[model samples]
Each structure stands twice: as C-alpha cells, then as structure tokens.
Target: MDHPSPPRKAPTLCSLRTGLALLLHFCNVALLSQRVCLSLTMVAMVNRSEPRGAPNASLAAPLDNVKNPVYNWSPQTQGIILSAIMYGMPLIHIPMGYLAGICPVKKVVGSALLLSSLLSLCTPLAAEAGESLVIACRFFQGLSQGTVQVAQHMVWIKWAPPLERNRLTSVSLSGTLLGPSVALLVTGFVSQSLGWPMVFYIFGAGGCALSLLWFVLFYDDPEEHPCISLHEKDLLRSSLAEQVSSGGKSVPVTAMLTSLPVWAISLSGFAFSWTNTIAFLYMPTFISSKLHIEMRENGLLSALPHLLSWVLSILAGHAADFFLARKILRLVTIRKLFTTLGLLPPALLAVSVLHPSVSPLSSVVGLTLASATAGFCMAGLMINPLDIAPRYYGFLKGVTVLIAMVGGLISSTLTGIMLNQDPDSWFKIFLLMAAINVTSILFYLIFAKADVQDWAKEWQGTRL
Candidate 1:
C-alpha cells in the first residue's frame, strides 16, 4: 500500500498574513517603548544637566525646577512611580487574557494599546496636575498593556504554522527588546534638548499611530484576514489543527493550577522578570552611579545590550526551528538546551557584578552578555505556554504574567530601598537575582514538556 504524498509545498514562503501578523506584533511592543522612555527620561527631566550657579551647574543641580518642572522625589516615591504599572497589571491579567481569548482579539488588543497611548499622552498633563495624576496614569497604562502578551498568543495560534512557530514567536517577541532599546537610545537626547515632555509626546504618539495601523492591517485569525493566500491559510489550519476553538473555552483553571509544567513556566517567568525589571528600570542609574556616566551617554550605552539581545533573540528562534526541522534533537532536549543557555550566563554575569574588583568596563560587558543570553529564552520559556496549551494559551499566559508582575513590583520597589542603604547593598540584589535565575531553570528542565497537555484538549470538542 502506498502512503499519501506529502502536501505540495506552497510557492510562497510566507504570505501577506504572516507579514501583517509580524508587523502587528512589532507595533504592539512599541507600546512597551513608552514605558522604557519614561524610566530613562525621568532622570533627565528631574535633574539639571550641570551644577547650578557653579562649575558644571547643569549637572550639579538636583533639579531645574523652573525650566524642567522637576520633581525632586525621594527614592521611595520614585520607586512607587516607576513601579505603578505593575500594580494594575497583575490584577487585570486573567481578565484581559480571558477576554482576548474569546473576543475579536485584534480589536481588543488594538483598543487596549490605543488606550495605553492615550494614557501615555496624558502623562505630561498628569504630571502637571500632581503626582497622584501621574501615578494614576501609569496604573491605567499598566491595566491596558497587561493584556498584550496573551492577546498576541491569540494571534499567533491562528497565524504561526507548526514549523514556523519558533520563528514567528521569537521575531515578534524580539520587539519587546527592540522597542525598549530604541526608546532608551532616543529618549535621553529628546529629553535633554527638546525637554522630557517631548520624549513622551513622540513615543506616545508613535504608539497611537502604530495601533491604528495595526487595526487597519491585521485580523485576529486567518479566516478574517482579507489578504491571506489560500495555501497559507490551509497550512496554518493544518499545522494548528487542534487550536480551532469556537472562542468559548471554559477556563482550564484546575489543570493549569495543578500542572507542574504550568507552574514551571510561571516560576521561570517570575525569575526572568525580576532580573529584567531591575535591569530595565535601573541599569542606566547603576551605570551612572558607578561610572559617573551622564544620563544621555547612559541611555545610548544601555541601548547596546538590548540591541544585541534583540538580534540574538530572533537568531535563537530561527536556530531552534532549524534544529527541529533537521530532526537534530528531541523537542524537550532542544528546549532544555536553550533554557540552559538563556539563564546561566545571566546568573553568572549577575554574580560577577558582586565582585569588588570588577571594573566599570567589565561590569558593562558582563551585563551586555547577560542580555545576549536572555535572547535564547525565545526558544524556551517565552514560547513554552503555546507549546503546552494553545487552547488555553491566553489564560496560561495571563496567569504566568500575573505572577511575574509581582516580581517586577518587588524588584523595582526593593531596588529603591537598596539604593538608599549603600552601594554594597547592590551585592545582595545581584546575589538574589542569580539565585532566582539558576533555580528557576532547574524547575523548568525537570518539569517542562514540548507537547500539549491533556487539559488543552478535554473540552475542545464540546466548545468548538
């Protein structure tokens, strides 16, 4: 008996649907840029460029209160402002993800991001009004952007072919690194010369524009897209045969809550987010404090690490797909390999920073290398939820994100507390991050899988 021939390969490599999906993912992350810009730009906004009525007057003054409308807040207050987003994010993750999984996800995502941009634009106005307004603005921005991860998963389940899953996911997720890098590079100059308000205005407006463009071009699924090719559509549907949900999945609360794999992924996210939150929120400050590098220079230098991270991240994605396509290793083996690569360098690098003899140049290089390792996570932690539960990808992502947001909040707030104690206090923080990194990876390696969990399929027929 002859077996059926393999389906004929489509002449097209990737269709318009693929391009639109990737670009839409890229735009979704531009919203993340607004947050990074604020973290870096606030430094320039609050402090003068030199010392006042003295040598280096611009740098010496704690505030250019007259020109900059500076807020000379204490570290505790600053921490609260910086971390306000996390406050709203964890609370909304389950709701946002639940809705995105059931609703017209593209519209839901677009509207959420649009609201974030509008809230971002109102930030300057909020600052002008009072600190409370600024805090409220950030809180609301968090609430809006919180749904973004799960919403994108919703899009990807419909768009990524099985073989192309790593590529699409990694490339799209690299936006998380790329957007923030670009924002860091640009925010300081805009804040320094044009004023901090200009940074917000530029990034916030770009996010708003990008969100509208996304709505115009992207559909939630292949069937709804006006421009997708037939072969591409067939490929997507066949590749993701099991994900054809009717948009009414009963939340897999019991399975996700009990699964070792889910818990592993969730804890991994927490560890990664904690280390990254510190880096994201305060790397510039750390460099400035240690090396006396000015804020603009700090911003530019900070960009290098994330720029490398983005490039390496997408490359890691492609590499993972290549290994799988060649049948070079088992899927579980591949994931563990990448997760090992992704987590250890960062842990070791974090440990290096604690050494008293580490030079400024070495410190910077170490952190950059750590970032490069972080890129490999695309092959593992970042994409594993979809691998394990496409049907519940949204809710799985939401739960993981909710746990991770707490990590972010604690890191941000604790960093402020540490900064006040002494420079040596950084040693403890670095040690904590390193411990979290290696420990989380062990949990992932032991419990993670490269196949779908049973719960993802249990109610599919009944719902779809």
Candidate 2:
C-alpha cells in the first residue's frame, strides 16, 4: 500500500490571525464611518442663515458659494434622526446573536454591513425626499448594522487565544473610535467641497467594498481558512480547546438572564453607551454653538477626542494583557481596575467643562480627556462577556449591547430635548452623565467576575 502524504498546509509567511485583526478593524471603520457621517455632515446640511452668536465672518463667503440644499431641522428633529439609528439596533441583536451560533458568522455580518452601506448610499436621496424618509433609512441601517455588533464577537470564539484576547479584541474595536474620528475630521470638508451627499456616497461605497473584501478574505474558523497554516491552526486549536465547542448549541437563557455578572456587564455597557452617545453625537453641535467654531474647523476639533480615544483604546488592551501575562493582578481585579480608570475620571472631566469662564482650549482639553479615558473600558466590561461565556459570547454580547443601545437611544433623544428647550443645558447633561458613570462602575466593582460561569461551561465542560 502506498503511504498517505500529510495534508498540505498553506505558507506561513503571513499570519492569518493578524490578518483577521486588520480586517476586523477595517470592518468597524467602514461600519462606523457610515453610522456617524451624518453627525458632521448635518452641520453643513442645515440652513444656519441666522447666527446663534457664534462668529462666522470667515465662513460666510465660502458657505454662500456652496449651493447644497439646506434643511431647517430643529434640534428636536435632529435628535430624532440621530437616535433613529438606535431604534432598529435593539431589535436585531438577539436574533443575530442566535444566528451567529448556527450560521457562518462572517456571512451574516458581511451581508448586514453591505445592506447598511447600501442604505447609507441612499441617505441623501432620502433626506431630499423628506426627513421621515431619512429617519427610515437610518432606522433600517441600524437594523443591519446591529447584526455586526453581535455576530463579530462569534469570530473571536474560534480565533482569539485566551491569553491574547485583550490585545486582539481591543485592537479590532479601536476601529469604532477611529472610524468616527476620520468621519468627523473629513465629513465637513467633504460636504463643503463636494456637497453633503458626497460624504454619504464616499463612506457608503467604502463600506460596500469592505463588505465584499470580508466575504472573500475572512472565515468563521481557523480550520475553515484555506490560507491558515497548520502551525497557526494547531496553536489556535490547543489554546481554544476548552473554550469553544465543536458546534453551536442552544444558549442557557434562564441562566444568562439571572446571572449577576451578566447584569453587571450589561449595566456597565449601558453607562458607557450613555456617555459615549452624548460625546460622539452632540460634540459637533457643542463645539459650533459654544465655541463659535466654523464647520470645517469644527470637524477638526471634534475629531481630537476620538483620535485620542482610538490611541488609548489600543494601549488599554496592551496594558490589560501585560498584567495578565505577568500575573500582576487577578483577572477580576484587572477588569475592575480598568473599568474604574475608564469610567470615573471621565465623568469628573466631563463635568469640568461646565466652568463659567471656560476657554476653548480648556473645554477641548476636558472633553478630549473625558472621551479618551472612556476607551479603557474596551478591556474591561466590554470584553468580560468573553471571559465568562466564551462559548456564547455572541449571544451574551447581544443581550448586553441591547441594553446598551437603549441607553444610547435615550441619551441622544434626551440631549436633543434638553438642548432644544435650552441650548445651555449641556451643564445639566454633563452632571447627569457623571452620576451615571459613578453608579455604573460601583455595580461592576461589586458583582463582576472573570471566571467562566458554570452554566456557560455546561455544553463543553470548559475550565478556564
């Protein structure tokens, strides 16, 4: 009998794991750019003929030259449109989370992102048709975009080794901040130079292209990847042996719903979402209204906080892994410590912007610090679901994020109402956010854990 040859392994010159990280980062970048493009573009899209006391001497001439149609949307209307994206997000998370367990997660996420991108392409037309149509487009975009949030976590189940989880996940998630940062920095200029519609077109097209690339390049599991080397596959298999099951199983619904650690993660996510929603969605309006910055410059300034956040997000991940590798701190302690670092100082810093004689520089510094510090949470409660329920991380993430989305939706709509009622209500909003941050961190400290829960291990008898 002829001896059987060993199975062929792909070349190991390029690491598929790192490739996955890069693709995930860009996926977030594409998805988030599409999501936040409206925030900056809205500044240029609105008819601001009447000055609200901000100096516009330099911008008046240039703005007059641009002939884009400007809508007369009130603060309330703008808030509704901004929050519309979140409306459909909650509806899809649980369903998508379940689907990720049974389906090829890459396909589900790629298809959803592609649909969302297509909707973004139609946004300008929707706006031209009516504000309702724009809101509808945003709502549907949220429905599609929401699937990515949950399903993407499933990819990590088979790919991220336990020891490197923080580094991989954080690096991938930093794209969330970087995506919006790039959008805020460029959307105003793009809107001004090529009309507001072009901003949507460029980002939407980019998202669609990325979606196509994901379909081609990414795989649900390392074993399924043709280009993944044998050594890499073996490494992942040994590292994830206990964590991931061979196939999907029904999640323990009652156990998840009753778990304190689960609630801690969900509530912590909610608090972060509330503060982040205010910072990202309303910062442009705040800078323009309070600092008297022009649209182009407003985009630049608004981007500073997010850029810092993107940098710190990656740093926090490295730090978390460093602690874990050295056994410097227990996993639970590390999670709590990072959570405190992320939430508490930012809350204080946000409140500092309420100073009576705050200068533009001081206000910018405060807000930037607030946003950057919050990025530390990426390695804290944000990744805790994976620690406790690696097998069902997708479903757990969906549940937590569903709660978080509610926070984002309320924060946006509430901020809009407050600002509409009194444009100077930012002080009150900051105070409320500070209170929320403190309360959230306290709950996480008291109840959060890093060990795998018993119910989460029932399917595979995992012990990490």
Candidate 3:
C-alpha cells in the first residue's frame, strides 16, 4: 500500500489570522467600552447619598467645581437605564445573525461600531434631553452593538480552522472582559476630572476612529484578503475545507431549533449571563455599598475581577487547545470538563463572598477569583456553536445570545427591585445566581456535543 502523504501544515510565521484576532480585540474593546461606560459613570451621574464626609473627594471636588448636573434617579430608574441596551439587543440579534451570512460582515461590524460611537457621543445630550432620549439612545446603541456581536461569529466561521477555533475566538473575545476592565479603571478618573460627559465623548470618539481602522484592515475571508500569504491561505483552505462550505444553502431552521445541543448552548449562555450581567453592570455599586470604597478606588478595584477574568480567559483558550491537540479527551468531554470548571467553583465562591465574617479584602478576592474562574466557560459554550454548526454559526449565535441576554435583562431588573426594596438583599441575589449557574451546568452536561450536526455538514461529507 502507498504511504499516505503527511498532512499540510502552515509555516510557523506571522499570521494574518492572529493579526485579525488582534484587530478584532480592539474592535471588541471599543464596542464593549461603550456598553459599560455608563455603568461606571453612572456612579458620578446619579446623586446618591453617601455617608457624610465620604472619602470620594476626587469625584466630589469635580462635581462641586464643575457643577456637573447629577440626576436624582431612583434605584428602579437606574436599573431601567442600565438595562436599556438589553432591550435593543433582542430586536437586532436574530436579524443581524441571519444578515451575517448574506452581507459583508466587515461592513456590518464597522457600521455598528460607528453607530455605537455616535450614540455614545449623544448619550450626555440625551441625558440632558431627558431620561427617555437617553434610554432611546442606549436602546439603539444596543441594536448597533448586537450586530457586531453576531457578525464576529461569521468572521470565525470563515477564518478559524477547527483545531484553532478556541484560541482565535478566545483571543478576540477577550476584548469583552478587557474592555470593561479598562473602562472601569479609567471612567472614574475621567468622570471626576473631565466631567461625566467626557467619559462618553472620549470612548465614543475612540470608537469612531476604530471604525475607520476596521474598514481599512478587515476582510471577510482568506481569499478576499489581499495581503494573506499563499502558505497561510493554503493551510486554511485545506484545514477548513471540511468545516465550511461554499455559499447558497439555506439554514435548516427547524432542525437547529430542535437540536438538544443548541438548547444546551443557549441555556448555558443564559446561566453565564445572569451572573455576568450583575458583575458588569452592578459590581461598582455593590462595592460602594458593601466595601465603602470611593469612586476612584471603586473603579480601580471593580476592574480587577474582569481584568483577572480577561487574563484567565486567554489562558483557558490555550489550555483548551492543548487538550484538544493532545487527544487527551474527546471533544465533548473537554468542553464539559471546562464548563464544569467554569460554573461549579464560581457558584460556590459567589456564595462564600456573602459570609458575615468575610473581610472586605477577602470579599474582593473571592469575587475576583469567581470572575476569573468563570472565564473558562468562554472555552466551553462560547465556541460550541462553531463545533456543531459552523455553517449556521451566526444564526445559532443570534438565538443563543438572545436567550442568554434575557437572563441579563431579568437579572438587572431583579437586582434593582431587590436592592430597591431592601439594600441588604445581596444574600438573596448570590443564592439565586448560584442556583441558576448549577442548574444550567447540569443541563449542559446532559446535552452538549462537539460533533457537527447532520444539517451542518456540506455535501462533500466532511465534518468539523
């Protein structure tokens, strides 16, 4: 028998794909900064009563001198404003997810960044214009940013090889955590020194600049990229030949809806979102109330969880790829193992932070570790859609994120209501989050898979 030819491998050199992931990292940074900018600045924007002579002199001095108009919005009102983007997101995710397949993903994502930037610019004016306009602006911003989120899945579909999926997606999506990490670290100082409105102005203008850069750099696929090397192109073409197909086939809507793996991804996403939403949007407030940290310190400290999470997510990506490459476990087993690692520890840690005897330093440490551990899920559910349905990954992502964001909406609203009724209700909140996290992981373990579904395969009979 003739010996089989060795598998083609791309040269170990600078990769356009890695550059693309980095560019996407910046794009994610810009977009998510817009998303969380208000979360941090809202501390300065809302004139909540602090204890007399609270050590927020840095923030107070700016307000006292600049006379930045602070709103006396109630807790419920603040919750509504924080959750406004979630409302806009649901309206656009499914449509944009479908559009990601048919449209130029670069244009869709670039335009979204531009729109989001413009909306961020308008946020202060909208706040001055009235609460409704601010809410409307945020809703539209959500719609715009939602497109970016859905479109990225399409980019991976075209660019990411099967074995490299975890690394590429993790490197790119790490921006999600990194954005908020940077935002929280800076927004407090910006709000204090330049006025709260400058927080929006600065991030919004940066976003617009990034959009221009995106137009110059991003391409939808390898063949379309003028600068891609022949070696890299050939490697991608051969490696991805099985996982992707030429265009024109309709998405198998009914089959995808009925797939248990899809449900597993969606529900697991919801579980993750419930906790993540609270962490991103409310952590500053939680710290202020519980630890009595001032705005500047609050911002710096609040960023630690997400920063640690961001770092660990990138590491988890590499670890995941290592496991996959080594053939140490089946694909489904690796995903499930990582998902368990992601969910169970964090759930227990979240509840631990509620202990009465836990010092302020210990609470912060516990919360930071919990957030860091949760990053493992990025290797789990975040990339599973690509494994099972690369052909319709965008559509699958849209559906999954829509369901997941419902948890965000509910979590924000419920947290607000609970806190509003009784400020000392964090115990209840942590319990609920832990319960949801555990319950969802069990379902994911039972149903999740890594094999490409029948409908996702091309006529060539290759599978991802």
Candidate 4:
C-alpha cells in the first residue's frame, strides 16, 4: 500500500513537463518549416520579376548611331534616364509602405508587378514617342519599382518566423542585386544581338509571368494558405499564438520615431543606401568617364562588382545567423560590426583617388572591393528591422527606406552637379560620401542596442 501510494509522483510530474516542452518545440519547428517553404517559393517568384537585360547592350545601344535613333543625348542624360528610378524611389516608398500595412500583401505585390510589367512593356513605345515620354515612363517605372521593394519586405515580415528571418530576407533582397547581374549579363547579350527595346520586352514578359505565379501561390498569412497541411497549419497557429502571448503589441509609429535606436538604424541606412546608389546608379558612368572605358566595357565591368556583392551578401547573411546562434554578438553589435567593416573600405577606396596614377582596371577593382564590402552591411541594416520589431517591421522599413531615399536623391543630384562642375574631381564627391559613412558608423555605435527599449515595450503594450 505504501509502495502504491508513493508511485512516482515526481516522475509523473517530470514526464508531463517534458511532454509539454517537446510538444512546444515541435510546434515551433513545424511552423518554421512551413514558413521557410512558403518564403522560399515566394522569394523565387519575386526574384523572377526583377528587370534583367544586357548591360553592355543597354549602354552601347544608345551610343550606336545606327541602332540608337536618340544617340544625340549626352552620357549624362543617358545616366539620368537610366537612374530616374533611384531618383523617384524616395518619393514613392513611404506611401507604398503604408499601403502595404493596410492592404493584402499578395494583392499589393501582384498589382505592383502587373503595373511595372505593363510600364516596362510600354517603355519601347515611349522611346518611339519622344524623350519626354521616355523620361515619364522611367519615372513611372521607378514608382512601381519602389512599391515592389516595399511590398516584398512586407510579405517577408508577415510570412517569415524570427529564426528564419535573416536568410529569408537575404534571399528576398538578393533579387535587387541578382536582378542587376542578370540584366547586365543577359541585357548585354540581348541588347547587342537584338536591340535595346528587346531588353524591356523580355523583362516585361518575365514580370507578367511572375505576377501570375505570385497570385497563385502567395497568401497573406498561414491561416489563409489553402495548400497548407492541417498539421502544419495547427503548428503555425500554435507557434504564432505563443509569440502573440509573449511579445508586446505592435509599436506605435510615433513612439518608434521617438526611439533613439530607430534613428540610429535609419541614419546608418541612409549612408549605406547612398553608397549603394552611387555604385549602382553611377558606377557605369564612372568607369566610362574616369577610366576612359567605352560603354560596352563599362557595362561588363560594372556588372562584376554587383555580382561580387551579391555573393558576399548571401554569405554575410548566413554568417550573421551563424554568429547570432553562437551568442558571440548581440543583434545590434553584429549589425554595427559588419556595417563598420563594410563601410570602411569604400571610404578608403575613395581616398585612393588621391593617387591618380592608379590604372582603370585598378580603379574598377578598388571600387568592386568597396562595393563588396558594402554588401556585408546589408546583413546588419537590411535585417535589423526584423530584429527590432517583427510586428511593425514593414512600417519601420518604410520609414528607413524613406530616410535612405534622401541619400539616393543626394547621390543623383550631387553626381549631376559634380559632373557639371568638374567631372575630374569626382574623387571629392567620393570624399564627401566617405565622411557620411564614417559619421553614420559613429552614430550607430553610440545609439544602437539590441535590447528592446523599455519605452518601446511599454508603448507597444498600450498601442496594441
């Protein structure tokens, strides 16, 4: 009787607790797996939508007297036309982010794709119409492009879990880099073989294809995914429920803006974006003008740096996750570390301009290294929004992007002014960028921290 009465109450209690823990862990794993599968599929679909065409071809065609009827425009004009998208991005991204916050992500993304594709298809028509029409089309293309970028970020926030977020984000964002690579390579070939208009036509067709795929496959949340398995759906609901129970509500817009860390990240983003825009929007021109390279050569050379950066970005993303898993660095520290390291090279390379004897190839190589280093910053700044506030990541991202667009606008205008004034002292413009990069790094080091601010958590509770 005594033996029966004592029958392992401790063991039973331990067994129950163990079972619950196992169940919870399994739920998290299952939910994460489902999210990963869905995210990968969506990212692949989104990646397909990026504009890629012959880089060399796109550049060379406008210079060719026979193929390019509008060859009368100067290189600066061509650069402006090509870069009109970056110039208009900041103007549109803020509203686009808010729109994503309110609307269905799938519809918003798909609609943007459809509109962008339609506009891309019409780009050739604009060329035939007139320069003003072409400029107008470029502006429209920029608006649509900005919307697509914001929508994709929003979709990732909604669909991806915390653990998988960085890699998934990297994969999604790699489209920006990859799109240019493919465009440079393919467009180079297509523009050379077929014509400049064919580049837009091909990208348009691809965009339309991706729009259809997105409509078919994407859902706003796991609860709504028709193809999700019952077990998987249950797991997702359970995991999300736990997060909802534990985490505070979405942080209010006003409170988020008031936070120091938010501005720190925003400032870092501004510098990072300006550097990226300079490289992406102006590198071709730099190679052509400074290096005395022909347009075709510039396109091929410009593509190399981006291709290098794309690879580096993927690696940096994975490396960041690995470092986080080891607890070697907090999220904020990791961002700062990578961002500081990445930013330094560009600043140094800009100063390399002091030595004018450097060969064009050497200059390209220096610029490429600078760009590749900047790619690592994406691991920090690009993925930090998820680290800070998963619930309002889309909105925060919108804010950061809006801030960053100021840099983009500055880059475009400054480049124009510098070129108009004395294109040779482009090194001075680089020096200005270097100062911005250094200042941003210092700001982030001082203000950015991984811990959720007490004010932020309290505000989230009240707001939600």
Q: Who wins the TM-score comparison?
A: 3
**Judged by lDDT against the true structure, how good is candidate 2?**
0.84
lDDT of each: 0.77, 0.84, 0.84, 0.62
Rank candidates, TM-score, best first.
3, 2, 1, 4
State residue 29's C-alpha deviation in candidate 1, in Å.
Answer: 3.5
Q: Each candidate: how many clashes?
A: 13, 0, 0, 7
Q: What TM-score, over all chains together, does every model reach?
A: 0.91, 0.92, 0.93, 0.80
The local distance difference test score of model 4 is 0.62
Q: How much is the lDDT of residue 307 in candidate 4? A: 74
CA error at residue 236 for candidate 4, angstroms? 3.9
Candidate 3 worst ten-residue window by lDDT: 51-60
lDDT of 1: 0.77
Residues 326-434, candidate 2, lDDT per residue (tens digit)?
Answer: 7777899889988888889878998898798877899988998998888889889889998898777777888999999899999999999999999999889999999
Query: Model 4, range 1-464, lDDT digits (tens) per residue?
Result: 12122111123123322222222222222211211111111111111222433322222233552443332343345545655666656777777766677788778877767777777778767665655676677677667666766766765444444444555556556556655555555555555566556667777777777777667777778777776566545544554553421122444767788888889888988898778777766666566566766444555776777678767776787777666756666777788887787787888886685476987667778888887787787687777766676556666777888898788767766776677567686778788899999999889889886665555344454343
The CA lDDT at 285 in model 1 is: 74
Clashing pairs in 4: 52-183, 53-183, 53-187, 54-186, 54-187, 54-188, 55-188
